[model samples]
Target: MNVGIVAAGPVHDIPDLKKVNHIDYWIGVDEGANVLYESGIQADLLTGDFDSIEPNRLESIKQNTKAINQFSSIKDETDLELAFLEAIKLKPTTVYIYGATGGRLDHAWVNVQLLTMFAEKHLDAWMVNSQNEMTVKYPGKYELNKDLSYPYISFLPLSEVVNGLTLQGFRYTLEDQDINQGSSLTISNEWSEKKGTYFFNSGILLVIKSRD
Candidate 1:
């Protein structure tokens, strides 16, 4: 299964819901349901405390969705977490998350951490917005297509250290370089050739590719 989760962030920054053609399931987090409804997309499940949505809207959502998992406002996990757990339970081949960025810094950071959690489970996931796509990767070789149109590429170490970092077809190549977390060594590298490749031997890294 391939699932898509919509969070209650900036709806305008999200890609057009109509463009997503192969979503097996749709999940709405809180007021995100309203965004989906406005975009003429139906949700398979809805999860959140309904704090951000008006009572009438929430009632309409409850009537429209197949399943609703309402939680207390003082729950332990965030709405995104709850939606992620449900998506994982479905064992999806890929989980595409929208409306996860361009909001509060704390929420954005937490959403990034959620990507790490999916990576730890050996799942393919991405936090995608209008301008950028973000994902975490374990130490390994990664090949990126040249025609993707993302102008800038960045690799950020998620652990204290990422060892044996190497890059090919990039403006700034690093061969067997060790990058420490919080270091600005791996930032804003563009492809110098047709294809770009990155490899690492240890630690997790967050790869971000952006168009603008």
Candidate 2:
């Protein structure tokens, strides 16, 4: 099953939920419930502290949502983390996260780090917004198709180094290279054909598909 998690970020940064395919369940976090409800998508579960959400909206969400998992405002987990824990119970194949980026810098960066947990679980997880789709991958071979909506692709090392990095069918290709953290060597690449491939022998890689 595929699941989507929507968090409280800039409303405009959230993609049109209806347009994403194969989303079997939707999890709304905090004010994201209002965004989902306003977008005409009822959430399967709502998990958050409710501090950022208006009381009236929370009431409406409670009425329409399938279930609720409310947390204390003083809890250890952030609202999004709570929502993610809820999502894990469903055993989804892939998780698409919306409204997670374009917020406070710290929140956004931490959310990016959260993708590593998904990677550890061997589940596909993406942090998506209007102009970007981000994911983390382990050492392996992977393929990508050209996406007109997100015309650029990038890879960065999440670890100190990603060894034996290679690229095929990309405008700026590499072969058997080592990319260190903080290196801008793999930024802003484009597909040279209908599809492209990337591979690395070791370390975690941060991949981003984006547009201007």
Candidate 3:
């Protein structure tokens, strides 16, 4: 299955939802249901406390959605996280998250952490917004496609250090280099060749790519 999750971030900057191809399922998190509706995209499932939406809008969403998973305002996981858990249960081949950025810093950070959760479960999850695409990487080899339109790539260590790191086809090459936490060593590396590869032996990394 191919699933798409919509969070509570600003939707005005996202591309036309109708232009997307082969979307088998759509999930709405909190006010995201309203955003989806405004974009003329129907959601398969709605999951949230309805706190962010007005009473009438919430009722309309509940009535229109195929399924609804309501939670109390006081909950451990964020609405987006809950949506992700539900999406994973369906065993989707790939999951795309919209409206994940351009929100509260805490919420954005938590959503970024969700990528790590997906990585742990061996799921392909990514945060896609108007300007950025984000994913979490564990120790392993990664093959990256070079998008000439958006060639800038950045890697931020999630742990104290990412050990034994190697980079190929990048402007800044590293072989068995250690990247410490809070370090800028891996920032803004461009693809010199058609593709790029990176391998790390330990720790987690947040990989972000964006256009100028």
Once model 2 is optimally superposed onto the true structure by TM-score, how far is the C-alpha of residue 174 displaced, in angstroms?
A: 1.3
Candidate 3: tens digits of C-alpha lDDT, residues 50-121:
798989878877777888898999998888889998998999888889988875888777788778878887
Better of 1 and 2 by TM-score: 2
lDDT of 1 at 114: 83
lDDT tens digits by residue: candidate 1, 124-211:
8888899888889887888876646678889999888999999999889999999999999888888888888999999998988888
- Collision pairs in model 2: none
Q: What lDDT score is found at residue 160 in candidate 1?
A: 87
Q: Deviation in angstroms for 201 in model 3? A: 0.5
List ranges where model 3 is wrong by over 4 Å: none
Sort order, TM-score high to low: 2, 3, 1
If scored against the real structure, what TM-score would every candidate get?
0.91, 0.95, 0.93
Candidate topping lDDT: 2
Q: Listing every candidate in turn, what is its Cα RMSD in Å to the true structure after a full C-alpha superposition?
A: 1.8, 1.3, 1.6
Clashes of 2: 0
**Predictions in order: lDDT:** 0.88, 0.90, 0.85
**Who is ahead in lDDT, 1 or 2?**
2
The prediction achieving the highest TM-score against the true structure is 2
